[model samples]
Target: MQARDTTALHTAAATQSPEPGKKRDTGVRGTGTQIALARSETPAEGTRHLTGSRILCADLPRTMARFTTGTLSENRAMLIATEVQDLGQEHRGWADEQLTLNPEDFAGESRKALGDRVRALVQEIEPVTALERIDDARSRRFLRLIPTGNMTMRLIGQNPAEHGVLMHQVLSDLADSKTAAGKGQGRTREQIRADEFCGLVTGEQNISPRVEIELVMTDRILFQAEAEPAYLQGYGTIPAAMARQLVRGRDMELKLMRWIRRTGALDLDPRPDLRDPGLPEPGAAH
Candidate 1:
């Protein structure tokens, strides 16, 4: 909820301090939290860097582009450069399963499972990010993209490498893949990948099995305040609660913005001088 620009988040990487037989996080977890999971370097036994706890942010320049066009906030496009981070606890269970598979087999199955899982993650991400913009206490009852409160697509025999490759591709697809919304046509899984790999060299970097991701968040945004939609570098817009969860934090810095006339109340019903108090507020009596 703090209004400060989160652009710094894009370049922020989790850092680790080597502890003999253990590890220490530099700032990835910040002063009071544990963000070291992703930025960890195995210092020694009983200690290792945790990888993958994250919050994908929007690329800053692209966000400003939207702002200049004045279309950024419209259609909730502020999220164009944004995406979600933080895999759910459910992902932990599944991810652990991937580690169980043999290297090659594990790679393939894990990658596919990852593809499907990451895809589903994006679906959940969009609504969460969208909800962050909704602080209108006037309507507590609103339709939001909530998790069915259940996880989907749990398959066995999936390999880690499979997940790595598949997750990268599928995540790539959702990053830039467009939807018809009202057009009725949707991209098939194959179609999605075809479009995603268009610019890639398909070598080790493009098709590498292991990759890394960084996550950052605020009470008001699911990902960064801005990002690159073309590269589909990050996920997509997310909600505040989701953002906090992604950042591996237990709370958020909630800041709300509002408007009032010097005389008394707002003369214009829908004024732009608005603030998001970070929670649903009671609306005027109907």
Candidate 2:
């Protein structure tokens, strides 16, 4: 569908006339096709999808045939497409033939295995292009935080394999030390490593004196031991008991501000301000 849309847009643009000194204006550039397809959210995501679609439609007939026949998955097809993109048309077609020659060979292959095979083939076919692709990949390394439910977040990143291995080793060593010292009792090595990573990044174990973490909840949840959950800003909903534990564990000082009512909903300011004495400080003794 995306390929068809792209081709139709290109044909339509080719027939249109340009202004005096300007190029013909076509909306199907960059993420325009992605938006038209409504398949991806970001431009990078859209471009990746479109690139895969174009490569399969225009360059890899055998692979496309497998994809159409449900023998190959879209993800694996896209992986192959992306791997062969830097090759010349003739070489790209050769790669397509080499990869898809044996349909039965892909039956139980994992995506990682398929990707590694494609990469190895690309290296054997053209070493210079393979090196260039490696450099390009290195230049595009990034880290992003994705919020998961239950007041947790997922940290996703890409880095050189060496650096990643070294970082993992360091975290493992720290976790082991904590385990030996009986500091992280009852926690798994993975959990301790995660805690150590957070401590190292946030300086919570060393330099951080007092960090402000926000937890918003209703008056009943905060004071009356209600069952309602509290919202931890930047994370997600956490149990009322967990929220109270955070305040009590951190020895946080709480000051109650004015209760603003809007549209029959009460808004409580969770931020602590020393000057605001509208209500007495709530005891964190729950």
Candidate 3:
């Protein structure tokens, strides 16, 4: 199958077991083995190329078929295949099923669309496990203040995706209002937003709008420990752990949604209480 990294592909093929009496190429390193072969090369670069092919052939065989058939580009095939490599076996299977069932949807799509579609389909490899991982990752969130040479300071913020979107929307709204009021204003939206941000931060403007965030989660995920990610409004989907954090200590009302198995429609759960007598306790014996 074709691969994003030709060097790695040839390397892996060269390393395959040789026919009887024919010795494997031990004297020469495979293209995939470049990092190990050369002292100057970084391991990460080699790993990316090497793992790309392995992921395609082993984890996403159907994608490999498409690659060999010239239906998918090497980069796109590698992109889709490697994305599921982090998922658990069950989640990987789900992703594979989606790809197989809807081949037409992925054909000739842009790289970003392909990535977003894959993320939408897979949700999380293992939501509970992924939640734990996101907790660990949260520690890395930060804000940096850098002073540029031109007497200006740059503010770099690294926040949760939902919060970032909220801030952007607020600033964009202020900027839009300012621009609309001024008839021949030539300032771009980006410039207006920057000025509005300065106005808010410097106490020139006192606008405190309550940020509204919407979360969509399955009942199984909310109370039964289902391995499904949560969808955050205005920010697409996020890990369930992040969703939990977003709602923690906040005054909010819960709305239950029931999935009609027959029609595949999501409707409001009429039952106020979430408890089900027929369902066994998590660890209870069948």
Candidate 4:
């Protein structure tokens, strides 16, 4: 998974067991509010946040899995973020238990903090849902994209030339995803989308994605992008300049080009075994 530091306002479930130890701590921008010293409602004590494996559960009253108890209060808490979605963790809202949201102020927290880097995404972890529009559900159509650096490119059409574009978009999406999540295509599908992606990117440290790329491939590379042009996750179709950049000085036989389509499926098949090839050139890093 790539590192993703999206500005979000997450609401903890009131149904969750009181934070362990139930002690109070001061609240900051990223950290939860300081509980401020207090007594526990029960026998449990020394309750700190339980950083565990994330278990996504939409429409779940128990969005928070399990953490030992800390203390209890008269419902006094602090703001965590701007992603105030209903059951959904990514969809954000304003009014940090104080402020209200204006139409133009959508993604306000993330914009103020991470800006263009934090994309508004509603990924389907389980049930496949019909994608909706950012502004209004009236336009419930899904948009194709290719993520590059800070922004995303919209995949408008398809063609052979589009394939080159698609390849670029997918790579950008993958790269962004990797940088955000800390995992890559080398990992299983599930492992690639874990919460670690968010922890590594913006929330942890702000690193510029634009620089250079150097893939040290010791074997032949089967690089088939969208044959016509395909849509990326947060980004849209691929870009021509990026595609042109990928085929630098590699052997002609090592690269495979194809046409990608807008609604086309990807070929995630493994590359064929290559004969013993010399060490790949260690190119410059961006």
Best-performing candidate as measured by TM-score: 3
Estimate every model's Cα lDDT from 0 to 1: 0.33, 0.66, 0.62, 0.28
Which of the two candidates, 1 or 3, achieves a greater lDDT against the reference?
3
Q: Would you list the clashing residue pairs of candidate 2?
A: none
Candidate 2, RMSD to the unseen true structure: 23.2
Q: Residue 31: error of model 2 in Å?
A: 5.9
lDDT per residue (tens digit) for residues 1-286 in model 4: 0001111111333323455676333222222222212223221211222111111222111212111121211111111221223224333221121222232333333432222212222222111221232213323434355666666443443333223334444445556667667656476544443433344443653433332222221111214322222223333322222233334423223244322222333233344332112212222121
lDDT of 2 by residue, 141-251 (tens): 798999999999999998643335446766877887789999888999999989988998887755322233456766655545555555555444445555555544432
* Residue-level lDDT for 190 in candidate 3: 85
Total backbone collisions, model 4:
57
lDDT of 3 by residue, 96-162 (tens): 7778787898767778778766765655656655555455655577988899978888989777665
The 10 consecutive residues of candidate 4 with the worst lDDT sum are 1-10
At residue 35, candidate 2 shows an lDDT of 46
lDDT tens readout by residue for model 1, 11-119: 2433444457744544433421222233242332102111211111222333334344553332222222122233344443343334224333323343334343433
| Candidate 3 Cα outliers beyond 4 Å, as residue runs | 1-47, 89-94, 108-113, 145-157, 183-185, 202-204, 216-228, 240-245, 248-286
Tell me how candidate 3 scores on lDDT. Answer: 0.62
